[model samples]
Structures are given as structure tokens and as C-alpha cells.
Target: MSASVANPNPNKSFEVVQPPSDSVTSLSFSPKGNYLVATSWDNQVRCWEITTTGATLSSVPKASTNHDQPVLCSTWKDDGTTVFSGGCDKQVKMWPLMAGGQATTVAMHDAPIKEVAWIPQMNVLVTGSWDKTLKYWDLRQSNPVHTQQLPERCYAMSVNHPLMVVGTTDRNFIVFNLQNPQTEFKRITSPLKYQTRCVAAFPDQQGFLVGSIEGRVGVHHLDDSQQSKNFTFKCHREGNEIYSVNALNFHPVHHTFVTSGSDGAFHFWDKDSKQRLKAMSRCSQPIPCSTFNNDGSIFAYSVCYDWSKGAENHNPATAKTYIFLHVPQESEVKAKPRAGTSGRK
Candidate 1:
């Protein structure tokens, strides 16, 4: 039994973490699997140590670093020595975990930085922005090494080492090979009608997942021969109320992905079998972001007024923003086996 599930709180289900003063835009677990980092509209990126063997959550962050504007995204480098954060200030900062956890601007985006991804093989970082461009940074330098212009602002992105895919505001599915960053890429039409809100690369790197605000998801395959395997489904919807699919994170080894939504619900799905293995009870408000640690034992997610069109209407109880920590059982994180006919996602 996982520590969290082994010792349950009679008064609540999951452990709640309260630190950020505003909406949390993104959450990531360190590669070391001992901490959870969050970027928020509070204009700060905060880190919290995980008590893997216990259920209590620390009310304070291990480190909190500020940005000029609301930070939208964050991720840890392959080693835990550094953390990269991006914000509405259009700046990307590298925060050294040592040295009092101070930050230094390493690069700048022409617009708010919506996402940051590190390419370990090339030892570079790529950022997407509302400026309709993706900038590649060497990290050791101050200026971008290369830039790729997009047709519209980037809304979501997913990367699998050599293969990268980004979803733009106009629903253009832009795919590229990072080994040759400037190589001409494939641009496919997104199958969803609403803006793409989140994406996740498949375990095999053969294709990726695309999610939209209309409570729908597209399972995409890269090759024409696998077109029949590509399909779309509806989720994040309840009766007549449609909710945005706020985020998606795949378990590091299981390929069972989790989805958080504006409905404040979290679901675990086996992408290969297309079966929902679990669903968390409805939370107070929307959950903007969620992530699994590299080992897939700890799950962290944020529930808040996600700045969606009708966010202000959420009740005060639900308006209280929070990051919840869940220590899932290994069995719960494992992907379920289906009949032999079930195929890859």
C-alpha cells in the first residue's frame, strides 16, 4: 500500500498543499522523484518536498522563486541541480537549486511563455509562446540558438526526445524532428473543433494525444498505414455542461495517462485499451495542471479557478486554490491488459 492510501484521512480523500496565492498554471515532478515544482499566476515558481512514506503535506515550499510576471510553466533538468521556469513576462529563467535558489534570465520570448521543454540529448531547451514562435536555447548561452515561426500562438505541446509535436491556436498539428531542428516538418489538421488545451506523446513515440476545450481528445498516429488506429473521443463533459481538458500526463513507464479537467475531476485511462481505470471524485473547481513523478508513484495536481471564461462564478469554497498530493498504489498506476486485439495509442 502506498503511504497516502495506506493512511487515509477520515475527513478528506487526498492531501492538500497550500502555498501559491493564485491559480497554478503548471506542475512537474523532479527527475529525482522527491519534489513537486509548480508555476503559477502568483508570479512564482515553488518547490515542495514530498514525504513519500507519509500522508502529511508541508504547508510551505522548500524553495520559492519569483518572476516579473505570472509564471506559466516549469520543468526540472535531467539532473536535479536546476529548474527552468517561464512566465507572462516573456522570460525564461534558470533557477539553481543551490545558492538560495536564485533565478537568472537565460532567454526571452516575444510573448508570454506557455510551455518549456528540455531536450537532454542536445542539451537544449525549447519554449513556445503567444508570439507564434518556438525558440531553442542552448541554456549555457544568453540568446536563442534557433527559432521556428508558427502559424499561430502555441496552446499546447508534447515531446518525445527526437520527435516533437505542438498544437497551435489555429489547431495546426506541427510535428518535427529535433535532431534536425530546421528540417521541414509535417503539419496536419487537428481533428478537434475547439482550441487545443493539452497534449501527450505516446510511450513508443509513434504518435501523440491532442485534447481540446470542447471535452474531446484525438488519438493520432503518424503513418498513413496506421490511420485506422487514429480516433477521437469525448470527455470532460457532464450531461449538457462541457468542460475544458486542462492537462494530460502519461505515467513514465505504464503508458496509462491521467487527465484533469475544468470540472475538477481527474481520470486515469489506459490509452492502449481505451479504458478508464479510475476517476477521482469531483473536486471544488477546475484543475489546471497535473503531473506524475518520474517513478510514477507520486501524483500532484492543482485545483483552482483556472482563468477560464466563467471562472469567477465558482463558489468561494471551490475558489480556494490548492495543489493536492496523491501517492497512488503501484497497481493503480499500471496499465491494464486488454484482449489481444487492443492496439497502441
Candidate 2:
């Protein structure tokens, strides 16, 4: 059964009222408000409104919709009033939140869609699928605006304005300059030695960070001149027992990031200083997905089985899923003075 533990600090974090009926696959915060959306393995997409009253935080279920198959990923439009979700059903559904409208299918793929993103700069929706292709949808049309073949099935993707990075099954990394969305800017293999679990672009758009199942992360820069700055670090391990780094999210303002892992722990780090900032207490179950709110004031994480052990180990009868809202203190997430250097890095 679930070995769930009590909240270590109730004031810092609180559990959401009602979470998904199944494992949560992804979590995203709206760009303009306190609304958070999650896509789950139960074929459902849910949105929650997070609010804080002095020292207490609470969540209210807002709106929800279902996919024909388990929803894999979701994204918010620039307006924050709409959401787009993709699933194993091979379809992308657009939901209008503020207007209280029904969701409608906007795009389709030949295979399960693993990741979805809304690019305000391009005014299009991008879907990466197991079909081994990256398709860009215009939303205005039934067909994709462009389809680019990938080296392998897309496993992870991260986008930051003019920069887009896609990590595929074979450790292939494809970087695109969205100013010219139709062409690839760079193609390289992952610096990590194992399959990529997650990826996040640097807020400055100069590089990207890739996490692997081997409990390691690689920091890569785009320019050859900055090649010396590239490095890798090991994390999410207990002695010789290592765990996959399942999610990586950069702070919107600080540029520092948080990494969640299969070991049921999460840590904040300053990439510029190459130093770990804070390591939170471990949960009873793995943290499958996590994200920072638009302002980085709140951190949302899912405590559930991540399926890293394959289908044989999942025990639905005993599995307990939870969504937590952690109000981060500025000192906990902000960067510190770099080593051997005075003042901020």
C-alpha cells in the first residue's frame, strides 16, 4: 500500500483538494495567472486555481476535459485563457478556459503525442510524437503547417522563444531557431550517456539543460565560443543507488532551476555558480512531474509512480497520487554569490 508520509512543513506546502484519478503525466502553470493545469494517464486534463491567504494556500478545481486516450502533455496560450493538450489518442485538443467553452480537436498525429507547446512568437502549436516526427500546427487549419522528421521518437522537448530543443529516443538532440521555424539550427547527440528524461532551455536562450535516466544532467551552450562552459553533474542518488531525473524547470526570474527525480526528492540549484541551493525532504513516492508558477512564487509537484520501473511494478490499488503547492522563500530559490567570487555571479 501507499507509504505516504505526513507533510514535513504544513505552512510551506499543502496538498491540493482533488487530483487526477490516475498518475499525472505533466503539470503546467498559466502564463498570466494562478491557474495550473495537469494532464494525466486517466485520459483527463484538469485545471486548478491556486490562491494564497496570508500563510495558508489552497486550490479550487476550475475546469476539466477528457481525451480519447491518456493525455500526455499540455501547454498554455500566451493569453493564459486557453489550454492545448495532446495524448496517446494522437489528437491535440484546445480548451478555452475563461470563456467556459468546450474543448475541440485542433491537430492529429500518426502516433501518440508525447509533448505539446504553444509558441506565441510563431502563432502555432508544436507537437512531438512517437511517430518520429515533429509537427507544427497553425490551429487555423486542420493540417499541420510543417512536419519535420526526427532521428527517433521524441522523448523530451523544451522551448524558449527563438530557441527549441528536442531530445529523442536515440540520444539525438535537435535544436531549432524559431525565427526560421522551418529549418534546423543544430543537430547533436546528448552529452549524457543514457536516454534523456527531460530538457529545459536556459531563460537567456543561450543554451539548454538535459537530464538523463542515469541521474545526471548536462549543461550545453549553443555557441562554439562558449563550449568551455558546458558541463555535467550527477544528482538524485543514494550512494550507489541512482534514480532518473524526471523533470527540470528553470525559474522565470532567477534563472536557477529545480530537478525532480524518481528517488522521491527535489533540489534547487544555481547553474551559474555550479552549486546546489536547497534539497527538500524526500516524499514517499516518486515525483513524476513539476513546474514553477508564472512568477516563481509557487512550485507544484506530483507525488506518484513515474512508471520508471516499467508496467510490472505499478500497483494501482495502492498507488496514492498528490499535487502539492509549495510557497518558495526567495532565499531558497535565488542564486548565491559564486564560489571564489565576491558579489553575485
Task: Please report the candidate that would top lDDT against the real structure.
Answer: 2
Worst 10 residues of 2 by lDDT: 1-10
Model 1 C-alpha lDDT versus the unseen true structure: 0.81
lDDT of 1 by residue, 1-345 (tens): 233432222224455565588888988878975777888888988888776436654434588888989999998888877899998999999998745667989889889999899888889999999999999999768889899899999888888978899889999989988778876468988978888999898878889888889988888998889998988888888899999998988888787888889888888887766778887777756789999888887788887788786655645543567788776665566776556756343
lDDT on C-alpha atoms for all candidate structures? 0.81, 0.91
Clashing pairs in 1: none
- The best candidate by TM-score is 2
| TM, every model | 0.91, 0.96
TM-score of model number 1: 0.91
Candidate 2 lDDT over 1-345, as tens digits, reads 233464423334688878998899999999999999999999999999998999888999998999989999999999999999998999999999779999999989999999999999889999999999999999889989899999899999999989999999999899999999889899989999999999999999999999999999999999999999999999999999999999999989888999999888889998887999999888767888999999999999998888888899988866778889888878779998765777654
